[model samples]
Target chain A: MRGAGNRYVFWAVALAAALAAPLALTNNYQLGVAHQALIFALLATGYNLLLGFTGLVSFGHIALFAIGAYASAILVVTFGAPFLVGVGAAAIIAGLVGVVIAMPALRIKGHYLTLLTLALGEVIRLLIRSMESLTHGSQGFSGIPRPEIFGMSFRAGVPLYYLLLFALVLGVAFVWRIEATRYGRAFKAVRDSEIGAEVCGVRTDHVKVLAFGVSAVFAGVAGSLYAHTMRFISPEFFSLGLTITLLAMVLIGGRGTVIGPIVGAILLISLPEWLRFVKDYYLILFGLAIWLCAIALPDGLAGAAARLLQARNSVRGRASLRT
Target chain B: MVELLSVRDVGKTFGGLKALDGVSFGLAKGEVLGLVGPNGSGKSTMINVLSGVYRPDGGDVRLDGRSLVGAKPSAIAAAGLSRTFQNLQIFGGLSVRENVLVGRDCRLRSGMLGGVFGLGGSLREEREAKSLAADLLEKVGLARFVDAPPSMLSYGQRRLLEVARALAADPKVLMLDEPCAGQSQAEADALAVLIRALAKTGIAVIVIEHNMRFVMNLVDRIVALNFGRKIAEGTPEAIRGDEAVIEAYLGRRGHAERR
Candidate 1:
C-alpha cells in the first residue's frame, strides 16, 4: 500500500504469464476459453471502477454489455460497417446510455438506485427481445466475424486470443495508471462517503456520471469482443443472471484493486471447465464458493493477498533491523 | 470589515419541527465565531444550511456576495467554503494523502481520459496535488502517516486528518462541527492552536463547540442560540453573562457539566 517496488514486479510477472498463456493452451478450444476469460476480465475490470471504486450497485451494467454486442453485430452484419467502427460505435452508444442511467443516481441513493437500475436493465433486455428486426429477437445474433484490423486477420483462435489479451492488458494498464490520478481518488472518496466527498469540493454528480460512462465504455468493448469471438449473441445471454456473474467476478476476486477482477474473471470462467467432473452440480459448488468468499474474504482475494504480503514485508523489515 | 459569509434570516423545518427560525449572522474575514447552543437549538442545522447540506426554506446564504442558498455542498466548496463533520468521515479505502487529494479534486482539471492515458498535463497535476496533500498533512502534523490509512490513526489524530483534508480545498471560509469532541485535553489544545493559525491566514472560521472553556478562549465572538433563534451575539465575555444564554444553559441538564 505504501508504493512498494514489489507491486510493479508482481504485475510484470502477471503480464509475462498472460503473454505465455496461449502457448500452454495447446488446443483451439482451450484458447477459445482463454479468449472468453480475457473478454470477461475486461468487462469486470470496468465494472470494478463502478462497483469497487465508485460504490454504485447498478444491475443495468449487463444491459449495456448487451447493447454493445447487438450494436456491433448489427453494424457489421447488416450495415457492412468495419469491425473497428462497430466496436467504437458500440462503446459510444453504451456510454451514452450509461450516462442516462446515471441521471437517476443524482436524485436517488442506496437501495433506491439499485432497484431503479434493476428495473431499467430488465426493460432494456425486454426491449432487445422485442426488437426482432434488429436483434433477431430471442433467436440470437450469429455469424459476426472475428476482428480484422489493418488487413491482419484474427480468424484463428490463437490470433484472436492474443487480440483479446492485448485489449485486457490495455484496460488493466488504464485502471492501474488512473489509480494515482485525482479522478481515481475522487472515485474512492465518493465510495467512502458521498457527503464527505461533496464537502471536500468533489463534484460527486459529475464523478458518478463519469464512473458510469467510462465503465460502460469498457462493457461495450468487451461485449463487442464477446460477440465477435463467440460469433453469437442473444437477448437471453444478457440476463440478470449474467449481471450476477459479473458482480461475483468483481466481488469475489477483489473489487477495488486493478488485478482483482481479472483474477476473478479468469477463476470464475475456468472453474466450471475445471469442475467438469462434478457435471451438473458444478453450479452448486460455484454458489458455495461465492458464499464462502463473501463471508471469509470480505475484501476479496486480492485484498487478502495484499494484506498477507504487507505483513510479511513488515516482519522481514523488523528482522533486518535487529540484525 | 468585509463579511466573507452572511447568513440572513435562514430557516429550515423538519416535519413541522422548526430547526432554524430566522437565524442570522455575518462572518468577517480572519474572525473565528463560536456557535453555542443547548441541544436541538439548531447549531448543526446552521452548519448544514451554510454548507449547502440543506436548502433554507426561507432566507439566503451568501459567500463573497454570491447567493449560495440552493447550491450543492460541492458547489459551495468550489466557491471557497470547506467543512469537517462532527462524526469523522475519512475515506478508509484511501491513504491519508489520497484522502486530502480528494478535497482538491474540484480544482484539479484532470478528466478520466487524461488519467487513463497518464497524459503529461494530468501527471503534472497529480504530482502537484500530491505535494499539496503532503504540505497540508505536514501542517496538521500527520506527515508521518501520509501513506497510512485513516483507520490506523487514533481518534484525535483522525480529527487532525479531517482538518488537513478540509484545508486542502483552500477555502476562504471553513466550518468545524464539534472538532474537539472525543479528543483528549492535549489533543484539543493542539487543535485550538491549529485553528487559531488557520484563522490568522484570513480564513473566516465557524467553530461549533459545547466545550465552554475552549470556546471562551478561542473565538473572537460568540453566538448563543436557544429554540432555533439567536438569543445572544457579542464578545465571549458578554455572552458568558448574557441572561438568556445563562438560562438557555441552565435549563439544559448538561449545563453545569459543560461549563
Candidate 2:
C-alpha cells in the first residue's frame, strides 16, 4: 500500500496466471465456469463504484444487467446486427438506464432508496418477461451466436476465456486508474459524508449518478458477454437471487477496493463446485460467508489485507531501525 | 463595509422553531468576523446558509453581488465559499491529502474518461491537486499526516485537517464552524495566527466560536446572536461591553451585575 511496486507485482502475477488459465483447464466446462466468474467479477467491480465507493445500496443493479442482455440479444438475433454492435448497444442502453435509476436515488437515503431500487428492478424484470416478441417470452433468448468481432471468432471455450479475461483486465484496470483520480475521491467523499462532500464542493448528486451509470455500463458489458458465452439468457437468471449474489461478491470480497469484487466473484463462483459433496448445501456456505464477512471483515477482505500489510511494513521499519 | 459578502434578511425554520430569524450582516475582504452567542443562537445556521448546506427560508445571500440564495452547496463552493463542520466530517476512508484534494475538486477540469485513462492532463491535474493538498497541510501543521487517514489524527489535528481541506479550495470567503472546539491552548493560538495570516491574504473569514477570549483578541469585529436574532454587531471592544451581547452569552443576571 505504501508504494506502487508491490501492487504492480501482485497485478503482474495475477495477470500472468489469468492469461495462462485457459491452457491449464482440463475441459470446456471449467473454462465456461471461468467465463462466468470473470464476467461476474467485472459486474461486481462496477457495482463496487456504487456500493463500496459511493455508499449506495442498490437492489436493481441486476435489472441493468437484464437490459444489457436483452438489448444485445434482441439486436443480434432479431436485427441481424454484428456482435460488436450488440455489445455496444448493450453498454449504451444499460448506462442510460443506470442514469435514470440514479435520479430517484438522489433524494432518498438508506432503506427507502433500497426499497425503491428493488421495486424498479422487479418492474424491469417483469417488462423483460412480458416482452414476448423481443425477449421470446419466459422461454428466454436462445441460439445466440458466439462473439465475432473484426473478422475474429471466439467460438471455442479457450478463445472465449481469453476474451473474457481481457475484458475483466480492462474493467479492473479502469477502476484501479479511477481510484487515483478526483472522481474516485469524490465518490468516496459522498460515501463518507454527503454534507461534508457538498460543503467541500463535491457534487454528491453527480457523483452518485456517475457511479450508477458507470456501474450499469459494467453490468451491460458483463451481460452481453454472459449472453454470448452461454448462448442463452432468461429473465429469471437476472432476478433477485443473482442480485443477492452480486451484493455478496462486492461485500464479501471488499466493497471499495478494485480487486475485492474480483476475488469475491472468483471465490463465490467456484465455491459451489468445491462444495459438490454437499450438493445444494452451498447456499448455506454462501450465507455463512456473508455472515462471517459482516462480523469479521467490515471493510471486506481487502481492508483486512491492507491492515496486515501495514502491520508488516511497520514491523519491517522497526527492524530496520534496530539494524 | 467593503461588501465582499452581503447577507440580507436570511431566515430558517426547523418545524415550528425558527433556527434563524431575519438576520443580516456584511463581510469585507480581509476582515475577520467572529460570530459569538449562546449555544442555540443561530451562529451555525448562518454559516450553513452561506455555505449552501441550508437554503435560507427567506431573503438572499449575495457573494460579490451574485445571489447565492438557492444555489447548491457545491455551486456556492465553486463560486469560492468554503467552510468546515462543527461536528467533524472527516472522510475516514481517504488519506488526509486526498481529503484536501476533494476540496480542490471544484477547480479541477479533468473528465471521467480522461481520468480513467490516466490522460496526461488529468495526471497533471492530479499532481497539482496533490501538491496543493500537501502545501495546505503544511500550512495547517499536519504535513506529516498527509498520507495518514484523518481518523488517525487527534481531534485538534482533525479540525486543522478540515481547515486545510477548506483552504485547499482557495476560497474567497472561508467560514469555520467552531474551529477550535477541541484544540489545546497552543493549538488554538496557532489557529488564531493562521486566521490572521489568512485575513492578511484578503480572504474574508467568518468564525463561529464560543471562546470569547480567543474571539475578542483575534477577530477584527464580532456579531452576537440571541434567539436567532442579531443583538449586536460592532468592533470586538464594542461588542464586549454591549449589554445585549453580555445578556446573550451569560443571561440577564450577568448583564444586570455588569451594569
Candidate 3:
C-alpha cells in the first residue's frame, strides 16, 4: 500500500475501534480501565518523542505529569475554573516547566543526565509536598469535578471513555504528524549523532529543549484527562513506580515507531488486571514479562510486529515477481 | 581569485598540551587544498577549529571576510562552512537519504507549528529537501542505497555518505578530515573525482589525509604540518619534494641519512 493511503486506513480502523470500545465492553469497570489505558497511551506516545526519536532518557516525566494533574485540580477545584481552562493551563504550565528542567538536564547526557532527571523528579515531588497550604501536602486532593463541555458532564462510563478516546486519537495524530516532518528528522539526527547533527546545521541544544517541552505538553494533557477521569489528584499517583511503569510502556512498545508505545500501554495496563486471579504471583510475572521484553524482544512488540509485516510483504512481492 | 576561507594564527591548548599553535592557511574559491601530517600533529584539530567544533584560543577564522571565531558549529555551518569528521559521524539509525536531508536543516525555515500543522509552506519545503537529499545521494553515487541505514554501509560508503550529507548543506567551504581513510585505491580515486567535481563547482575543498598517493593526486595545493605547525605550503609537487615535508613524514635523521 502507498504510505499516505495506508496511513489513512490505519487511522480509520483505529478510530472505529476506539469509538466502538465502550459499546463492546459495556461494563463500567472495564471502560474505566480502558480509559486509564488511553491516558497512559497518550503519555507514552509523548514520552516516546524524547526517548525513541531524540534519544533522551528522562525519569522526570512523571513530575510533568504530576504538574499537569495538580495544575488542573487546583485550578478547577480551588478556583472554580472551567475544566477546559484547567486543561489548557495544565498543558502550558507543564510545557514551561519542561523547558526549565531541560535547560540544565540537557547539559549532561547518558547516565549522568538520567541521574540528574531522577533528582529533578524527586525535587518536584518534594516541592509539591512542602507546599502544604496549596497542595494539602501528602494528604492529596480529592473531589476533582468531571470535565464538562457546553454543560454536558462526563462524570463516568461511556461519556468519559469517548472523551478520553478522542484525546488519545488527537495525541496519536499529533505525534504522527511530528514524526513525518523536518523537526522529526532533526530529532532523529540529534539522537543518532549530536556532532553530526551540529555539522549538518541543526542546533541540537534548541532541538533537545523543544523536544522536552513538546513531550511535556503531551504528558500534561494526558495528566489533565487522568485527573478529571479519576476525580482525584495526589503526589503518590506520580511516584517513582509510575515513572518506571511509563518507561516500561515505551520500551515494551518500541521506542521510535508511532504504535509501539500505545501497544505497550494497552498491554501493560490491562495485563495485571487480567492476571489478578493469580494473586501474589501477578507482580512477579509482570516483572518477568518486562525483563523478557528487554532481553528477547529488544525492539519491543510493535517493532517485532512491524518487522514481521515487512517480511511478509517482501515475500509476497517476490512470489508475484517469480510468477 | 577570491579567498573563500582564511585561518589566521589560530591557537588551541588543552591543559599542558598545545593541540594547534599559530596555524594559518588561506583557501580560494574552486581550490582543493590537502592538509597532511602524522598522527596527533593537529590536522584534525585544525579542521575542528575551522569548522567551529573548537574555539581558537588566539587569532581568527574568516569565511568570505566575515569572522567565524567563537561561533558555534551550527552557526559556522550556517555561515557556509561544513565538515566531515575523521571518525565517521553519519547518523547510524537514519536512512542514507535522511542523513543527507539533515544537512539541509540549516536552510529550512519551518518550525514546530508548521511541522505539526503540515501547512503548505512547510510541506513544500519538506518536499524540496527530500528531492535535494535524493539529488545529493545521486551525486555521491549512493542513490541505490538511499533507504539503507548507515550500519549497513561499508566504511568507504559511510565516508562517501558523510560527504554527501555535508554537501547537502551547500557550503562554500567544505572540510573533509581523512575522507579517504581506510579506502581501497579504487575507492580513493572515486573520492578524488568527487572532490574535484565539488571544487569545480567553486567550493573551497579542504581534504585532510595521511594517504600520500590519494592527497597527492587530488589536491591542487598542499599544506604540511608537524608538531602543530606548518612545515610546507605550495603545489603538491613542491611540498612532496620539500626537505621539511619529507622530514615530517620520515624522521629528520632518516631523511638526513638518505640525503
Candidate 4:
C-alpha cells in the first residue's frame, strides 16, 4: 500500500482494536490493566523524544514523571485545587526539574550522561520516600481526585479509559506537530551528529535542553493522569522498573517513528500481564523476549517488520525474473 | 571596505604545546581570504579558536569590533559567524533539506511552545524555511538531492552540501575549512567559482585549503602559517612565490594541507 493507504489500514485496525478491547475486557480488573498500558504509551512517547530523536538516552525520565504526579496529587488532595490546575502544575514542576537536571547533564554525553540521569532519578525517588511528613513517605498518598470535565467526575473504569484515550490522542498530535517543525529538525540534527549540527549554526545545547524540557512536560502530564486514574500515588509506582519498561517500549517500537512507542508500550505492558498464567516463569519469559527482540532486531520490532516487508517484495521481484 | 571580522592576537596552548601563538588577521566585507599552512600549521586550530570551539589563551577576537574572545560556540553563531568542518560534518541520517534548515537556527522566529501548539506564526515560519532551504540547495547545486539523505551523496556532493548548510544560516561571514580538500580538479574549479560568487554577494569568506592552484587563482589575499605561527600574508601571487610556504608544503606532503 502507498502513502494514505497504509495510514487508512493502520487507523482501521487501531479503531477496531480499541472498540474490541472493552468487549474482551469484561471486568474492572482487566480495564485497569488496559488503563496502565495506555499510561505507558504516553510515557513511552515522551521518552522517545530524548532517546530516539535527540539520541540522548536518559534513565531518569521517571523522575520527571513522578515529580509531575506528586505535584498534582498534593495540590488536589491537600490544597483542594482544581484538577486542571493540578495538570498545569505537574507540567511546570516537571519542566523546572528538567531544566535543573539539564543544566549539569547537558555538559556530558553518551553513557556517562545516562548514568548521571539514573543517579538523579534515584535521588529524587529517595527524597520522596524520605519526606514522610509531606508525601506520607512509605504509606503513600491516597484519595487523589478524579479529573473533572464540565463538573462531571471521571470516577469509573470506562470513563477513565476514554479520558486517558483523549489524553493520548492530544499527546500524539502534539508530537506530530513538533516532528514537522524546525525544532524537530534541530533535534534530529543533534541526534545524528552533534558536531555537524553545531557547524550548521544549530545551538545544540539549547536544542538538547529544550528536548528534555518538552519530554518532561509530556511525562509529567502522563504522571498526573496516572495518579488520578489510580486515585492513589506512591513512590513504588514510580520505580526504576517503570523507566526501564518505558525505555524498552521506545526501543521496541522504533524510537524515531510516531507509532513505534505506542505499539511498543501496549505490546510490552500487556504481554507480561497476559503471561500471568505462567506466574512463576513470567519474568524469565519477559527477559527472554527482550533479549530475543534486542538480538534479532536491533532497530526494534517496528524496524524489523518494515525490513521484512521490503525483503519479501525484493524476493518476489527476483522470483518473477527467474520465471 | 568595512571589516566584518577581526582576530587580534588570539592565542591558545594545550598544556605545553602552543597550537596558536598570537595570531591576528582581519576580514573585510565581501572579501575572500585563503588560509594556507603546513602540517601542525594551526590552520584548523585557528578556525576552531575563531569559531568558539576553543577559548583563546591570550588576546581577544572581535566581530565588527565587538569582543568575542570568551563567547560560547552558540553565542558566536548567533553573532552571525558560521563555519564548516574539515571532515564534512553533515548529518548523515537527515535529508539535505532538513540539514540546511538546521543552519537557520538563529533565523527561526518560532518559540518552543509556538511549535508545540502549532501557532500561526510558527507554522508560517516553517513554510518559509522550507522554501528558503530549497533555494539554498539550488544555490549549492544540490536541488535534486534535497529530499535525499546526506549518506547517499558522494564525498564531493557532501562537501557542497556542507557549504550549502553553512549558507543556509544567511551568515554575514562564512568560514569554510578546506571546502575543496577531497574533490577532483574539476569539482575544485567549480567550488572556486561558487566561492567567488558568494564573496561577490558581500559575504566575507575565509577559506582554509591545500589546493594551491585553486586558492592562488581565486583568493584576493593569502594568509599562510607554519608551526602554529603566521609565516606569510599578502596577495595570493606573492604568497604563491613565498619560500616559507614552499618549505612548509615540502615538510609534510599531502597531510598538512589536505585536511
**Collision count for each candidate, in order:** 0, 0, 0, 0
What are the runs in model 2 whose C-alpha is more than 4 Å off? A320-323, B255-259
The digit string of per-residue lDDT tens for model 1 on A180-290 reads 788888899999999999988888999999999999999999999999999999999999999999999999999999989999999999998899999999989989989
Candidate 4: residue A138 lDDT (0-100): 73
Question: DockQ: which candidate is best?
Answer: 2
Candidate 3 pairs with clashing backbones: none
TM-score of each: 0.97, 0.98, 0.96, 0.92
Off by over 4 Å in 3: A1-8, A313-323, B256-259
Better of 3 and 4 by DockQ: 3
At residue A154, give the lDDT of candidate 1. Answer: 90
Candidate 1 reaches a DockQ of: 0.81
TM-score for the first chain of model 4? 0.94
Candidate 4's docking class is medium
Q: What is the lDDT for B128 in model 4?
A: 90
**Across residues B180-236, which tens digit of lDDT does each residue of candidate 3 receive?**
877788888888998998888899899898788888888999988888888889998
Candidate 3 lDDT, A176-221, residue by residue in tens? 8887787888999999889889878999999999999999999889
Worst 10 residues of 1 chain A by lDDT: A1-10
Report the lDDT tens digits of candidate 4 across residue range B169-195: 788888989888778888888888899
Worst lDDT 10-window in candidate 3 chain B: B250-259
Q: Give the per-residue lDDT of model 2 (tens digit) for A175-293.
A: 98889899999999999999999989998899999999999999999999989989999988888999999999998899989989999999889888778899788778778889999
